[model samples]
Target: MNGRLLTGYVLRRLGQALVVLWGAITLSFLIVQLTPGDPARLMVMGGEGGDAGAANEEQLAQVRADMGLDQPVILQYLGYLGRVVTFDWGTAYSQQRQSVTDVIGQGIGSTLELGAVSLLLMTALGIVFALGSVLLPTAWLRSAFQGVTVIGIAVPSFVLAIALLQIFSFQLGWFPAFGADGLRSVLLPSITIALLGAGTLSQVFARSIREVSAEGYVEVARARGLSPAQVVLRHVLRNASLPVYTIVGMLVGGIVSGAAIIETIFGRPGIGNLYVEAVSARDFPLIQALIVLTGGIYVLVTLIVDLSYPLIDPRVVSPAARRTR
Candidate 1:
């Protein structure tokens, strides 16, 4: 739990994440390659394959050669790994003029802008709701808050987004229906993203906190003249919160992957939109690249959360961390 130990633990976990990412990328490439699609034919549809039904064997072979598809899968994977380490993601086959890194880089930023802000919103609101549901003095207030949380959980993001658009954009004409521009544009989308996250997290955290509060440590703290707020903040909160932090990290990963629908509804130029297009056009390389990228993101977030564990509880320690401590 000491600073030195935490740092070492984080570093080790990062190394493991790297390995997991490599495996994910390799698997994604294998799946995409083995499946049927012709990026070259898709790119130059009218000129190359207009008369034909699809890319012929010769066309597929030529396309493969042009894109270095002739190289062994292992070799290609190694090359991809090397490029990824250097942040040099290859070019998209369809958008030959634009670099794949550039496209994904922009999309990642856009997605992050939406995801991070929404995450913050969700966590704060969820925690507040959890506190209200469990800690609030009045049963009626608790029931009302719980009802709202249930409603939030039931409403799907896209449906919510559309409804908000209708209410705020169509009816009120307050913000653009589909864009990530000023605060106006993000308002509805952010709300929709936060609602689902908060609804789920609040339910989880409220239950956790209630259980922790009833534990012996909480009773002991209360016995020792520590106020309810003090005990909850000092002992109960930390214990109940440790798991939530992990869930938060997983939620971040979930948001990154899960916002595709919301992003599509809002016409946000995020990775989700690209994912949709790639699937539609059967852009194997792009799809493979996205899969790898998303996996890497998930692994990275999970590692961060793992490293955060001991910090929240002084007792927990990993091997590298123990040595450092």
Candidate 2:
């Protein structure tokens, strides 16, 4: 791609990312605001054994004022946007007035670690399955690989987590059943999340490989006296793998979302568990911040994937840029 086109492509992708982030932030704010039950009242009464009379008017009003709930919706939204931009996510009333950043910080590391491990496993599994489906010697073997991918896609994360826990933890005592203590603690959850993504990616990759294998260039390569493995490794693999990049980027969001359920089931500490706590306690700031964080991650990953196209294949160009030209 020309320098001018590349610059325009980057700028266009960035603009789209900003718009998506803004929409996500705005939607999260609106949903939290519209949800039944007052956060301030919830905060005041959460510790009072569910008694409505536990929190008086002054207490509720004070809590509301402290939480900026007394301000107009527009003002609150503007204030929220400012906070998000500044990375000042405010305090968590549900956590004894702890700073939101500190609260999230305590768990973000574990979540990122889980996500990173899961991503690696997912990518490796996808490539293996794709290659097996296409390169295996027998039809039944290829069919078996395809069947496994279908099962992986069909199983929900929680159900998979439970089954794995039963077999690996309870039955064999192979790994810890719960908690984020060490590497062993991460294995089951990561595997559970990886299987889901690997299933979709392998299917897409297998199709791409089949299409690429039919191209005339592939035929010429085979006729050039190169071995089957050499032609596949040198030519088919690179081209067939291009589409897999986009699938990997999209899978990140699923990994994070799945983390919530997997973490809860496995008793792991992460943003997913924090999210559940924030919602249960009506901690608006924490809830909104987590939503924005998840959305930002999705936007960033997809943006990176889009920008990488030209690097992966020079012939790749933005369709939007092409139209403009």
True-structure lDDT of candidate 1: 0.75
User: Model 1 clash pairs?
Assistant: none
Model 1 worst lDDT run, 10 consecutive residues = 43-52
For all candidates in order, the CA lDDT equals 0.75, 0.86
User: Relative to the unseen true structure, what is the Cα RMSD of model 1?
Assistant: 3.8
Candidate 1 C-alpha lDDT tens digits along 184-264: 777677778888788888888988998889998789889999876787778888789876787787787668766788889
| Best TM-score among the predictions, by candidate number | 2
What tens digits encode model 2's per-residue C-alpha lDDT throughout 1-325? 6787778778988999999999999987787588777767776666333665678899888867755789998888887788789988777777777888999999999999899999999999999998898878899999999889997799988789999999999999999999999999998899999998999999999999989989999999999999866778888988887889999999999998988999999999999999888877777778888999999999999999988878887556656635753
* Candidate 2 global TM-score: 0.93
What are the per-model numbers of colliding residue pairs? 0, 0
User: Given candidate 2, what's the lDDT at residue 228?
Assistant: 69
Least well predicted 10-residue stretch by lDDT in candidate 2: 43-52
